[model samples]
Target chain A: MQNDTPELPIFPLILSHAMRPLPLWPLSAGLSRLAGHILHRHPGINNRIDYYQDHVFLLDITDLPLFLTLEPRKARLRAFRRSAVVPGHDAGISGPLAAFLAMLHGQEDGDTLFFSGALAIDGDTAAVLALRNALDDAELDLAAELAELLPPIAGLLRAGLPGMQHLTGLCLQRGSAASERAW
Target chain B: MELVCPAGTPAALRAAVDAGAHSVYCGFADATNARNFPGLNFSRAELEAAIDHAHARGAKVLVAINTFPTAGEEAIWHAALADAARLGADAIILADPGLLAHAAERHPGLRLHLSVQAAAANPDAINLYARHFGIRRVVLPRVLSVEEIAAINREIDIETEVFVFGGLCVMAEGRCALSSYATGQSPNMNGVCSPPDHVAYTSEGDDTVARLGGFAIHRTPRGAPAPYPTLCKGCFVSGERQGHVFEDAVSLDASRLIPALARAGVSALKIEGRQRSRAYVAQIVSAFRAVTDALAAGREPPALALARLAEGQAATTGAYAKRWR
Candidate 1:
């Protein structure tokens, strides 16, 4: 069988490296806005993660030189440079960006990723589980969400998503698309 | 033999059916089911669609209202039973005696399969349930050996189902209160165990500690693959014994014992993990389907490398071989 180990693409690594010295405030603001838009679009996500309203989660994208802390109650997401002092978090989920995206798009199973050592969770297992389940139920399509955010790029995004997914082995949509892929 | 697969959501139900599950079992979104985790399980309308989807493909849909009903909340369980019957479920897997009596009396036409949570391991208990509630099948708990199961099957009149894969409960089902003691919720009462909300992990120097209800369960080195902090599988210290005390953090995989279980007159093989993803459901269902189909055709069952799906990336036969003594 082929190696199912997730590998980070060189493009993201290069981009991450280039952004290592840049200020993260603008990126943090954009991420917070995107999170707000998601919450606005899918109100039920709030209820699903209600137990974690006060909890803070650190999302560490291992392949990228970025760290994100999400505060669900405030609908805020803060981005930090990899070299910056790590912010305190109640729970943490560390993984490659592809694995995170794959999980987000329902392209991979969270437990399967964890068992395969593609993902490492620390601090609060329950909180992370709740967030994963909430996202799974929401079935958030990041491509679509972004397209909706910028209608001018909607068609371009919709057309490019499949190719991007193919190139990256990332799941950009929800449904049984992952079932067709080899384990 | 039948292949019963778990479906935590409607998508997973379809995945299981599409992957060739003979029957798919799911639960209502409420606490009526054992896998009542946040954002998991099916709504009533979803179940309706899921049942239609399964039935169209020649697969049966089993609804699990297995959790014991709270004293004042029996009506909720009753309503779930009513909805499941109204939704054309193939059968309802239940555990509570009162709930079983309610189902048998009110929905007599709805086939009833005893849940593993009932822990009906012996002939007398299975016979009693069969006699009292007219149950058609009994899902034996994970604590029985193949010889013990075969022996029980000899004296029982009803069909028997045994867990073939997925999570293994170290204690007798329905009787354990460890999770409730730690987290104030349990599979029997609240349809959850060591609920995620009560669990937390912390980085203490080079070790990451997993705690349940504030009691540390596991402390693994940084970057090591850590298991979920289920109380039964946790590490403990008992007089200089600083290791897993109750059970190892391993999932049950009886794929190699399909032939023996078939010989034991087991009517069905059940896979656990309703909280799993559709990807998991599809993969596991197809693997088991291949095994059972091969067994039926007298062909050698293919070896399945499913360790990546097992808890702690390890598998065990549990009490099936009575090796844990």
Candidate 2:
């Protein structure tokens, strides 16, 4: 069978390399500030945060090698990049970049990923449940927020966002066809 | 015949009970049950409350610990049964023979309902379970026709339950390894089939494709609804027929056959969506309750007002009719 491996563009590879050396603290601080403002808009979330008092969550995007420690106890939520001292988090959820994004945006159900072994969670499950419930109730639009953060790439991101699903579908179709032909 | 409804959470259990379900079935929040999805099932505290609530309202609560146990981990399934008995479950639904034997020996007073996951299609298998483990009820596999079911009923003294509505599994229950082949996790061991984490949907050009474990299972035009890519109900190439080879992305809607099923000596009718929301649970349970009520009244069953609730906007009687065979 002819090799049908979908070649990934070099951009993400370059970006991933460049992101490794860059200081993530500033970005994490900025995002946490934004989360504070957003949390105030959803009182239900503010109340749910109290249930997770002092509980910190490590959200690891395993595919991208990036991690964020989320503190959800205070009036405003805070996101911090992983540091050596951030070892004993109350809970940690790790998944592929796409599955995490899909779950965050409510496009995909969390149970689907967990059931499919796409996502892994460790530590306090109750803390994870509280955070999931709060986020679901708030319905935060991360895409819109990212667009606001990067105005020049806003249109490009919006265009690329819709294509993610299509691209995923295309890759699978091509891959399956290749495997079947090989058989 | 009784109406057995599914409940994912305590709220859904209440909704099912309020909607007139004669019995509400649910499972613990772990891999012990088939619908072991996130944010579903009941914690111990919640199950106690739910059972209390259902019992007070004249509805029985059946605890489903139906998934087959993994090798070297039979104790987990046993512990679940012990907890169910301690919690006053009206009956325990089970699929594993070893677990059934343990339940029979350990908790003799607890009622046993053989899970559909057991795939007990014929009278011999059904009777074996009834006789050896004292299983009082058996949920028949979906592969059998009504006539086959009637024949089985004539031969087996145990009560039988049948799925009347909700999602359809093309493969025989307890016998499907497709999900495991694709995702390394299966309904039998992990209690999840077509797990969402392994599913990916992407758009390419003007079409959207649904993939499971890197295999394309379905493709739809942009703006068209893409069904969940369960392996059996997927579009595939077979010779020259490149369409749904096994079954379409339609749900089981046997609401029209309640009378026939009742006549076939089916002891209960089951609705099959524990992953659904409380509103969905209430609506479906209420609709099925109406059908059973109409049959009891000696009147024609009401028209099914549940097309909107079915998967992919379509429903079929599945293998219940001979032509589907």
Candidate 3:
């Protein structure tokens, strides 16, 4: 019989649409594809942020003043011991992970916040808390623009909402916070 | 079944004992304890008294030297173990492979119970620890199902203690990076997750922004109660989602599952949150004591008497129900 199936979409477009159904998806490939898109757009962040080994992001804590690494697939983290140059894409926080990062800068400026549940965390539960303390040496307030991301970029995230919700549910549900309003 | 309760200070040990804790766990006020907060935990002098106090009550004191020691500073951990033994602790809760090995050799008769930080999720790993380091009791990770727990119980000769109430750790210990990327220090070494000092909430226009370690974890209405910007529970913008990708802000309460856990043959019930008040600890210990007592007597737990103690006034059975991926 003659083949009549639709050919696979172009690699670039396919890469553009790649998404992990799991909430904590690996940032390596997704971030690489994101790098591809960023290279298509601004390109400078790729120069500032290195990305080679399994999606590592080095935050320019000196220039922008925050060093952060996120592993979406696993709900844990590894905090750098000191402020130094490391060869990895440092994910500079201009978004959600920002305020708590400021708390790591060492001021009791944060609010009456709740934890997801006493039990649920992504990667290393202890490491997550330690990383927060490591950043607790200074007071923080990210650049205003980075605090609330611009609408155009926000649209990109909103477009991928369902997949994000499903993945987050996978990551946190059995978590104490799963009983919270949104879960 | 045993009741493993928290004792942040020497005095808390007395309270936990007076409140009827079967065994109490406390940590050094340094990086050694998972509750490595300032002004919490016991000093060497305090430990001597606390151990003495628990001993007087005929209860056991399990020193929690659980956080992974710094790569080269294993000596700090070793000294803590020596001190615990010197002061007469009933057992030590350990997580690190090297430390467990060290304790097994250095303090052979100290009675070791593996910490949840060890993340022993299966029989093979549990057996490895048991065989390698002579671990007598294993605190199973929060990832196992009751059926899994029962199955592990059947195979392992040692006792198994699963976390029954208080905070739940959905992810394995020593594996996450969400906080470190934002701040620099994290739990595996620092013994905290989303440390309170790194948490901030700011008002911008109509939205409230919650940040942890310089990362904005959530954005809610200005007056709404913002959950702590814990990386896992915080809201984020990913692909098409703009909500908590890991979990929302809530605390774990597993009272309803006590009967199931008892059937699974668990040796003890662990309560999280050592930084909580003595009143909080006493309340939870008493409540669980009642539940376990009733479970021991083959009766049902009393109606929800400890509901208000949880963060966000919510609770879960966690993975003991076994639905997590």
Best by the DockQ measure: 1
Q: Stretches of candidate 2 above 4 Å error?
A: A1-183
For model 1, the stretches where C-alpha displacement exceeds 4 angstroms are A1-12, A21-26, A32-44, A50-56, A71-78, A85-91, A115-117, A122-124, A147-151, A154-183
- DockQ of every predicted complex: 0.35, 0.03, 0.02
Model 2, B1-325: lDDT tens digits are 8999988767568768888999999999777887766456777877888888888889999999998888898888888899888988999999989899999999999999999998889988999999999999999888888999999999999899999988887677856777778887766655556674566655578866777778888877654444546888889999988988877777789999889999999999999888655556667888989899999999999988675556554678988884653
- Off-target runs (Cα >4 Å) in candidate 3 are A1-183, B205-208, B220-224
DockQ metric, candidate 1: 0.35
Q: Can you list the residue pairs that collide in candidate 1? A: A123-B201
Give the chain B TM-score achieved by candidate 2: 0.96
lDDT per residue for candidate 3 within A16-69, as digits (tens), equals 234223223353444344434323343222221212223433332222222345
lDDT of 2 by residue, A1-183 (tens): 011111222224554556666566676777676666566555555455445757878787664535777776553333333344444577777766665555454344454454334555666655665566455434456656566666898898778866754644211111111112110
Worst 10 residues of 1 chain A by lDDT: A1-10
State model 2's lDDT.
0.72
TM-score against native, each model = 0.89, 0.68, 0.63
Say which candidate scores most in TM-score: 1
| Per-structure clash totals for the candidates | 1, 8, 92
Model 3, position B319, has a per-residue lDDT of 76
